[model samples]
Target: MTALLRAAAGLIIWAIVFASLYALQGLACALGWDKWQIAEASLARLVLLAVYTSGIGVLALLCWRYRPRVSRRQFLDRLAFAGAAAGLFSLIYTGLPVVAASICR
Candidate 1:
């Protein structure tokens, strides 16, 4: 419900995205995805990470900017957004191996 907490959540989400992308790249290499596949997918992942964080940042800034009618709800909503984004990263991290294994076979 505070700006500090919202910003902290944003940074935590960013770190999760960074770590997930690094791990996924490693998995692709381990799976022997060619350079082209790895490069292409990496770029896509970067864009996804940007969009995920940017969306949350915008919401946080909006809460800070306008002090929305439902301020407490907006604060928690931003936190939930970051948490969901991190969850998405975790799912992708856990699933990439299964997906690559299936395809690599």
Candidate 2:
């Protein structure tokens, strides 16, 4: 049971980050965060960037934590590491558009 949970942790975190960013984007747009500017970028963009950065940080940490050690030669460990890597890739690929694309439109 624990091994199964560990193997799936990366994907679970990815799903959480993905949903949170989506919800935040909608909330920011509805609240008119685009009207507020900080250093030429809209507040919405800044907030999204911060969240996206945080997500990346968390995924990186998970990847590091789950990385296969020399002594831990187990199938589940390898699967967990792979899952973490995949999750990191997925987060970056899906979240990039949110950071680069126009907000509130």
Question: Pick by TM-score: which candidate is best?
Answer: 2
Model 2 C-alpha lDDT per residue in residues 1-105, reported as the tens digit of each score:
989888998888889989988999999999999999999999999998988899889889989999989999999999998988888999999999787889999
lDDT of each: 0.50, 0.90
> What TM-score does structure 1 among the candidates reach?
0.35
Q: Write the per-residue lDDT of candidate 1 for residues 1-105, one digit (tens) a residue.
A: 465554455445546555655565566556555333444455344444455455455445533543334545666665655554554455445445433443222
Number of clashes recorded per candidate: 0, 0
- Report how far residue 43 has shifted in candidate 1, in Å: 10
